[model samples]
Target: MPLLDVKNLSVNFNTLEGTVRAVQGVSFSLKKREIIGIVGESGCGKSVTVRSILRLIPMPPGEISEGRIMFNGENLLALDQKRLRGIRGSNISMIFQEPMTSLNPVFTIGNQISETFKVHQKMNKQRARKATINILEKVSIPSPEKRFEEYPHQLSGGMRQRVMIAIALACQPKLLIADEPTTALDMTVQAQILDLMLQLSDQFDTSILLITHDLGIVAQTASKVIVMYAGKIIETGSVSSIFKHPFHPYTIGLIKSLPRMGLRSQYGKKPLHEIPGIVPSMNENISGCWFAPRCDQSMDICRKVAPLQKYIDSDHSVSCWLFN
Candidate 1:
């Protein structure tokens, strides 16, 4: 069985104007010791999809209308808050996108990391301190013993991110969800962090649910790729199939949009291509295919009737009129 299985997940946000469908019927399964990348532009529901797995989105404004997040053969969505809390950092951990803000400014780094051990393992201060320093050391934080005493502000951006990873690993969870984990870092640092995550996952035998907007990052790190648009999954397949035989126009546009470094303009800037037209607003009903408005190859059927997901191969699936 898959280590983590998320199926037919839909999340909506209630607003004064109307209900905003942030995620729509998204489904996928993850295996232990594997990396799956969810790739899309901003506002594509990638973040919200993962957030629902842990029941992180607040109610009143946010609601998980329908979904099943099966982790280790248990339904995570059905679990109450207390039960969910027990699983959040121990069975499945999240390393959020922003490290500078995610860390509690009022607490020392050691205090923040130690909280998990104290709460879950009921470890004494001495043991928690040792585990905290060991986790920091595992993530390559320098002089972890002393760094543990420092506040979040004292560390650089990269170091702060390492601290975030350290906290996520406090319990050595079986699955790790990294939401844009390497965002805003330099290229060298980004590569190092990504490589480190894969290495650690292999070392600990954990699965990874990687969410990122950078296709280049996905191309490098993902064994499988899920392409989402607006609030729905439009395409999914192995990295090779998504790269070589992308059937959906949105996926094609994204691949084409990647800047080719070898092909530079006279000005020495890489000539980047762009997909014209912004993503359509969700104000009106999302009839037919949501991407039809932005698709260059959109047809009458694409604009008027929604396309159901079609299987192209055993492992490749796409939702587009062209594929049918």
Candidate 2:
């Protein structure tokens, strides 16, 4: 069985305006020790999808309206709170975006990291502290011993991110969800972080769900890719397949939008390509395909009926009327 299976998952938010469908019929799976990248623009349901896997979406305001999240032969959405809690840190860990907000301002780095060990591994304070220091060093944090006593606000952006990585990998989880882990970092630091994550994944034999808007990072790290747009997964394939022959217009647009090296104008300036039109608001009831309005290759059928996912080959699938 695949390590993680998300099948036809849909999420909705109950708001004053209306019921906003944040995620719609999203499905994918991660194999053992594999890295899968979910790429999309902001508010495209990438984060909400992963958060639902962890049962983190608050109820009343938000709900998992349909579908199943299967992990290790169990339905995660069906698990009790206590049972799910047991699986969260030890079995599946997450490195949330924005370390400053995710990390507790009052707690020392050591305290926070060690707490994972204490709670999951049942280690004593001394042993947990030692383990925390080792994890810090593993992530290439400078002066691990000194940084242990520092709070989140005291560290640089890169250092704070490293600490978050340390905490997430504290128990050597079987699955790791990194939501835009390299956001707001310099190119050099971002590369370092990605390398560190791959190294740790190798060491721990962990499967990763990497969520990011940056396709460059996806190309560098992920073996497979899932392209999401307007709360739906528009395409999925191996990294090579998606990069080489993107079947969906949305996927094509994203790949074309990447800034190419040495492809500059007469003035020695490279023009970056952009997909025109904005992502539709979730609050509104969308008709036909969510991407129909923005798709350059859209047809009359595209605006009248939603396209089902069609196989381009054994490894590639795209949801577009062109394939249909």
Candidate number achieving the greatest TM-score relative to the actual structure: 2
Candidate 1, pairs of clashing residues:
none
Model 2 C-alpha lDDT per residue in residues 1-324, reported as the tens digit of each score: 999999999999999999999999999999999999999999999999999999898997999999999999999999999999989888999998797899999999999999999998899999999999999999999899999999999998888889988988989999999999998788999889889999999999999999999998898899999999989999999999999898898888888888776667544775667788999999987778999988888899998888999988987999999988
For candidate 1, which ten residues in a row score worst on lDDT?
A: 262-271
For model 1, state the Cα shift of residue 213 in Å: 0.6
Q: What is the lDDT of residue 264 in candidate 1?
A: 65
lDDT of 2: 0.92
All models: lDDT? 0.89, 0.92
Clashing pairs in 2: none
